[model samples]
Target: MGKMLTVTTMFLIQMIITFETSGLYAMAPILSNNFGINHSSIILVNIGFALAGICAPFFGVASEKYGKKKFIIIGVSTFLIGSIITSYANGATLFLVGRSIIGLGYYNLSGLLLAYLGDIVAYSNRGKIYGIIRAASGIGILLSPLTSTYLISNFSLKVYYLIIAFITAIILLLSFFIPKVEKRSSYKISTVDIILIFRNRDGRLFLFLNFSMGTFLVLYFSYIAVHLEAFFNLSALNIGKVLTYSAFGTLSGIFIAGILSDRIGKLKLTKIYYLILIASIFLINIVNIHFIWIITFIMSLSFDGGWTIIQTISSEIIPEERGVFMSLVFFVVSLSLILFYIIGPVVYSYGGFLYTTVLSGFFIIISYILFLKFAKNNTEKFN
Candidate 1:
């Protein structure tokens, strides 16, 4: 019963985050025209939201020193407030403020969710269960863009955010059921520890891979719908449908990767995911409307599959310092946001979506090359 509740709550968190994020992207073109600004202005909102990720390492140490459930409650409470503030936003400044608050709360909840689950589930069964949760997140990927389009076109952004706010309230209630673990005597991310973490080769490899995957997905969410509208003359509804179809690809990957990670071993499965990522970006860019969905699905699959393995690997590394290690790993991933935000718009301005995908493919290729160059069999294993 408890495990079921925990999984259900984690899935809800995935849904709302997807809901807001997909909506922001889908709304970008529409909002740009309404505000008389370019796409950059609307996409810049992600920077405000991503700023909260900067504090993750501190939150990680704090979660260990304090308790996981306590912070989750605070996170949920903060998210609820942010949702209210966002719903009432009439201008970009106000919207940015609301999203910033949402980010603050959101990173807290999202950062801790998997760790909370790890505490309860046995190691042997963990990967499979994690896969199921990730696949469920695909439903959010499937619906949010479509939902955002229909709501914004027929009603208002105000109504849409309010609905998100209501759902957040329920999540706050669900937050209480997350079982608490006993706290350790002391937890600290010391200066030596920080330095050593960066010096660790596998840490660097996975971190680079994580960053590449994260930045690429950010670009996808920020641009794909707009690209369809701009290049293909796709209506909002058709763009949503396209995104929805691509999500099935992600669902297939997450479900398959989860089962395979456990069966084939994470390292073996990871290699396949990397190749798919590099290949998908190139293919996705070259394809026409008729073939875009196939490539997009393949691309989407690699992103989520790679992430699932990354999450599991982080949990396995430094079990005693799992919270700190996981947080630090994600902290590096967060840095990608600032870099991508600045560069994504410039890339799009130069040659449109095609340039963006090509640049992203280069990044993935670089990450893969670095891994092959530096990685050792023992690197991923705790040294």
Candidate 2:
């Protein structure tokens, strides 16, 4: 019962964070019109989480020594405050500030959530719970579009954001119920200690895989909506509906990856996902909207499923220093987001969506090669 509560709490909390994260994208068209900003500027707003990730390694080290639950409290509190600020923002500047703070708070919880799971759940059975918890995470994005449409259409953009605040507030209150966990590591550490994550052989492979595959995080997302609007003339409601349908892919991906990862082998299944993601990216073409939707669905499923497996293996790579390692992994993930946001728009602007997909496909190809050659076995012998 106790473990169930923790999993449920973490599951719900992850869903909320992804809600806030994906909501900005779902609500982008409205935000652009209301604020008089372009797609690029709207997307740039998400850089906030990447910015906050800079501090994550330090927090990771602290959590290992001090406690995860308290930092979790602090993180959720920040998210709540940011959500309220977003709900009440009067203009583009204030709105950006509010949303930026939400990103800053996002990684504090996101990076730690996995590590927190590592603390209570042993490796042998971790996949079962990871599937449930992580699959639940996809639900946030699945509904963000529909919910954003409802709130903005019926109430106002302010209400749309405030609903997020209200939900977050409830989550903040429930956060207190998280059972206390004793410190996981006794060693003193600093931000520099994260370098250890790179020292091991598996750690090096993880970093490579993270970078190659990490770009997938924002690769298509940076301009998918803009492309849809420009090319297909889809309205916000239609786009939201489309993305909602696509998010089901994430649900399926998480479930299958979670259940099968333990039995089949994490790295092996990850390879298949990587291939699916690559093929899906290659199959992306602007000629047909239905084709695009199918590709997007495939991408969503493979990305979430494969990445979950990668993160699952990551927790075991440096068990004693998982906090530091996860922070480092997230830090790389932040870099990946930064890379796409910075490079994606430029490629899309000059080259169009085709060029952007090609670039992303090339990145994954490199990642796949590195994983196959270097990580010959599931677990690299790390000393």
Candidate 3:
């Protein structure tokens, strides 16, 4: 009975994260146009979210000391408030602040959702369960673009954000329904422990892979809409269609990678995921054919699918430190994402579309080689 309730709560939390992120992404281009800004500035929507993720370690420690249930409820409520503020934002600064607050809420969801899963499930079945939770996230990704695009076309951005705010409110309400979860163990969070986490060879390797893959995802997602607008001369409505298709591809990858990881082992599957992702980015750069959405969908499948695998693998790297390690995983990923925000637009400015895309691919190749070299032989330590 206890286990069943835990699974249900985790699944609901996954849904909340998925819906919030999808709505934000769907609103990205609209926010850009309304604010009179470049795509780079628009990319900061994600940056805000990533920045929130950067703070996950601090929050994780707080969760341990204060209580996971308390932090989660507070995070969800705060997110709802931020969503309301974002709906009314008039300038970039106001919009960004609001978005950053939303990011804080999302970090709680995204950073802790899987760790929570890890806490409740057995190690042998962890990969498959993680995959299921992430795949569930794709449901939000699938719907948000479609819904946001429709709202923007017919109603107003204010209305769209209002709906999101309401959804966030619902999430907070649902959070209350979660039975109190007692901490099984605790740790004193200190500066030195934080340093040890980063300096350890195994820990550093996991952090690097987490951040690098995160950067790669942000670069493509942040730019793809703008790329379509500039290159294909597509409207926001049309671009949403392409994004929706891409979301479907991501779903396919999420489920397949999750199943594969259960059978083949994360270490072995990771190499394949890395290579395929590198190739996919190159494919995005070189492909010039007119079937716009097709190419976009394929790229989404490859990149997001690959990302799902990396995420699952990283979760298993330091199981004893699930809260701390997950926090670091999210934090480093968020930091790299901020770097990508700057890197993507600056590189796109000089190199244009194709060159910028190819550059991101090169980064993946470098990181892939490094992870392969540093990864341990057995999963015993992680367990």
Per-residue CA lDDT of model 1 for 167-232, tens digit only, reads 989988998996787766576668898788778766667667778876886666678877888888
TM-score, one value per model: 0.93, 0.94, 0.91
What's every prediction's RMSD, in angstroms?
2.2, 2.3, 2.4
Ranking by lDDT: 2, 1, 3
Best prediction by lDDT? 2
Off by over 4 Å in 3: 1-5, 24-26, 45-47, 184-186, 374-376, 379-383
Query: Which 10-residue window of candidate 2 scores lowest in summed lDDT?
Result: 374-383
In model 1, which residue pairs have backbone atoms overlapping below 3 Å?
none
- The CA lDDT of each predicted structure is 0.76, 0.77, 0.73
lDDT string for model 3 (296-356, tens) is 7767666666677677767776666677788888888788888887777787777766766
